[model samples]
Target: MINNTIVQELIHEIVKEEEGVPVVECLMEGSITDEEIAEKTHLKLNTVRKILYKLYDAGIASYKRSKDPETQWYTYTWKFESEKIEEIIKKRNQEIIENLREMLAFEENNMFFACKNGHYRYTFDEAAENNFRCPECQEELEYMDNSEIIQQLKRELSLYENNGSEIAFNFKSYS
Candidate 1:
């Protein structure tokens, strides 16, 4: 599994930077009134109202309104849903795995060549385009064996396969 500390930190950082920190925090705590959130966050009432509206529209949080008998103004309360955070993190993990696969394929299968006398290497096409001659030594270029590259790619893919499911599971647990 991915480290719980890393996952928790990522979640905290994302939520903290969200436009309505007070609303999010209050919602996470339980249903809380807008005025209470504003007071706790040290933000103006109008600003807190705007933040609540935005959070509601984003579907990251929701609210209920209760009419105050003394003033007749609707008091807004909020709550956060855990599912949305899980969905976002799961999508990110899928993208990372796809990118890793693409990189491994490129590293393992793409043809390469290198100059015997120097440390330079080129792809098969590059060597052919250069008349099979090393630009530095004027020596003929030959196809480099790719077994080592393929082996390394296999190793990396194995690591990903081993860890990817656990990472995804941990991310879900956080949500």
Candidate 2:
């Protein structure tokens, strides 16, 4: 499932806001040069190289450097780590689940206070320390019912726990 949405989203996160999906799709065609990928994806060569480097840093892409005997110039042939993608996804999902659990626990254990504009949130101790006033707007802080937030976190945690182990692999090619 290299081209699937989950994989694409992961790549997007690694590469930031740039559109890395098309570049990833091109890499799934087997080992290829960055220039070839740029041409195939209609992306700027520099942008393609940047994405390749970022993916490499993230352990999702790798490259082999070759020296041309005639020109003595180096060329990089890049390959996507198709096998590692699923593992990366599982690890990241687990981290997210753990963070969600912590947040849920914090919400369950403490009361929250917020400003009228929702610009700030503080735990009971923090609110008390500040005399129940917003630091930014100087408005009186009011008790914020966080049951909805707690429920949302629980639902998200449940989804991740249920689906974290069943990531399917259907990559087109591996190198």
Candidate 3:
């Protein structure tokens, strides 16, 4: 399983880099008042309110109001839902796997050809359908070797397999 440190780092990076709105790093901490968020993040109360609203609309956070009996004022506490992070992580991992699978298929199954003069390449079917000639130079085409691409794809597949399992296990353990 991935370490907690790794998951935390991923969350931090994602929150910092997400577009349009500031992501709350303390979502899981508990519902927090706008004033509390402003104090913690050094942002103005209005800005904190906007960011909190954005997070809420994105389904990334939730809040509840607590009334102060003495002053009759409402306050909020905020916390993060661990399940949301897991869902995002799992979706990202699935996208990676799908892209990698396409790469592996192209490397393992597609045939390629190279031009002798410019060393430009074409897929096997393209060369064959064009009578084994380079379309750019009208020169004979040579069958390109797949060994290097195949080896690289194998290495990438191994990495995905290893990391995917680790991340999945971590998500389960945390959830």
Local accuracy of candidate 2 as per-residue lDDT tens digits, 1-175: 5447788788989998465888888888889999999899888899999999999998989999999999999999999888788878888889999999999999999999999987899999999999999999989999999999999999999998887755642333322
* Backbone clash count for every predicted candidate, in the order shown: 0, 1, 13
Across residues 45-156, which tens digit of lDDT does each residue of candidate 1 receive? Answer: 8877776665566555677878999999887777776566555555665776687788778767678888998758887778888998998888988788878877876777
Please tell me which model should have the higher lDDT, number 1 or number 2: 2
Model 2 misplaced regions, further than 4 Å: 17-19, 113-121, 130-144, 168-175
Top-TM-score structure, candidate number: 2
lDDT to native, each model: 0.69, 0.87, 0.68
- Alpha carbon deviation, residue 164, candidate 3 (Å): 2.6
